[model samples]
Target: MPCPPAVRPGTPQWARCRAMYTSEETAALLGFSDGGVDEVLINEAHWTMRNLLLEQLDERAQMLTGRHKSLSMVEGVQHDDVDGIAFIGYHAGAGMEGVLAHTYLANSITGVWVNDVRASEGLLNSHVVAEYGVPVVLVTGDDLACEDALGYAPGALKVAVKDHVSRYAAVCRTPTRTAADIRAAAREAAALATRHQPVRGGPFTVELEFDAEHLAMASTVVPGVRRSGERKVAYTSETMYEGIRTFKAVTTIASAAVEEQYG
Candidate 1:
């Protein structure tokens, strides 16, 4: 209903995460709103690749993800080197009412918690960036997504490109209007990208609840992860960095264990 009651705020610091396009390094792109990314001159490659990635994940969850063969999100960027980050096209966490609501997996994971706080990708990522003093400066998505951002990035600029009607439907704005809205928000958001002291909130107890009992059992393959209940598993990480990586592992294993029609 409401953005996970009193979820602990993570990385609320301000910092600059510059999105440099082809030739112009200063030109800012507002990013995705509603179902698709707002078509921008620089968004062509990014948008296409994003769709491809999503298709791959949805089609082949068992094949593994960034944490494996290819560069993962965590390994791709130097968290310490980043000044800030942007969470564009975010949605509510799994089990919440929002567009295509799910955590890392499509439908396997029912919930994710950090320090026992029900967390969305934005919240989990905000904590990751916070470890290196990177503040989340801009978050764009549906109205609920914008509302979710308030808990994690209270200072970051928010733009709701659409109003959620159902998991698959929304009252979307014209591409023209959304682009303009995101552009203005991005401009202001850039100024909020001022880095602050790195947060060392650790000893995090990361937990995941799955739809099937076997998925929970499968997650135990990861080191230090153990079943906390009938359909839930939990792990402890000293840092959010490791926490995310482990979470990724758990999801990968659990998804790989999925049956075609049953899962």
Candidate 2:
């Protein structure tokens, strides 16, 4: 899919930015026609300053837009036909330095771990896709985000569009400069796109540490979830697919339990 072209403030530009870059630099590298891909867009955020810049996509690509998807942001990766996945407009995880850093939920999750490593969304999704033998071909974001990708997908190409200073700020590159870098990187990344062995790492035990006691207690509403400590809950599953689904349920319940004034 072509990356969104219109860069907006405080939003991750994932595919949009990548599309701009690929159009300019990497179009020939991946052996894809200059403009031949489809985009499935999802609006997982509450608000943004500008709409995605769709105009930048080459004539060969098409887009899907709107919100409320079953898989949330990565709705397209699971499709059997998708050859590779790209992490675009990504950022550092919660408590890390990068623009708009957070996991699935901005304030609810304190941390998420994958195979005992501190994970950002890119890392988590990388593991999820690996289960289906999908390659993560390109990652674009702040420098730290690229660094995070290295832990999960070292073989993929990376494009660092900015240098992190704080959660909400960065020393950013202009769209023009970043586009050039991303295009070139993506072309090479495309070469790494072949899928490999499907990985199965489980019976996984997921532990979620909430910021408050009530949040932990609330998570127990999920059938197998249990409070493991004063402010922590844990659940076990036979596969990461089930593990992640259960983790999602726990987060949903915990988030609803949060009180505005005290939590």
lDDT for residue 160 in candidate 1, whole number 0-100: 83
Question: How high is the CA lDDT of each candidate model?
Answer: 0.64, 0.65
Alpha-carbon deviation at 170 in model 1, angstroms: 1.0
Deviating ranges (above 4 Å) for candidate 1: 1-79
Task: Write candidate 2's Cα lDDT for 84-142 as tens digits.
Answer: 77776687786566667766666666666555567687876776778778888877788
Q: Give candidate 2's whole-model lDDT.
A: 0.65
CA shift at 192, candidate 2, in angstroms?
1.5
**Each prediction's TM-score against the native?**
0.75, 0.78
Worst 10 residues of 1 by lDDT: 14-23
lDDT of 1 by residue, 76-111 (tens): 334355455566567888888887677867677889
lDDT assessment of candidate 1 = 0.64
| Clash list (residue pairs), candidate 1 | 14-193, 14-194, 15-193, 15-194, 15-195, 16-193
RMSD of 1: 11.0
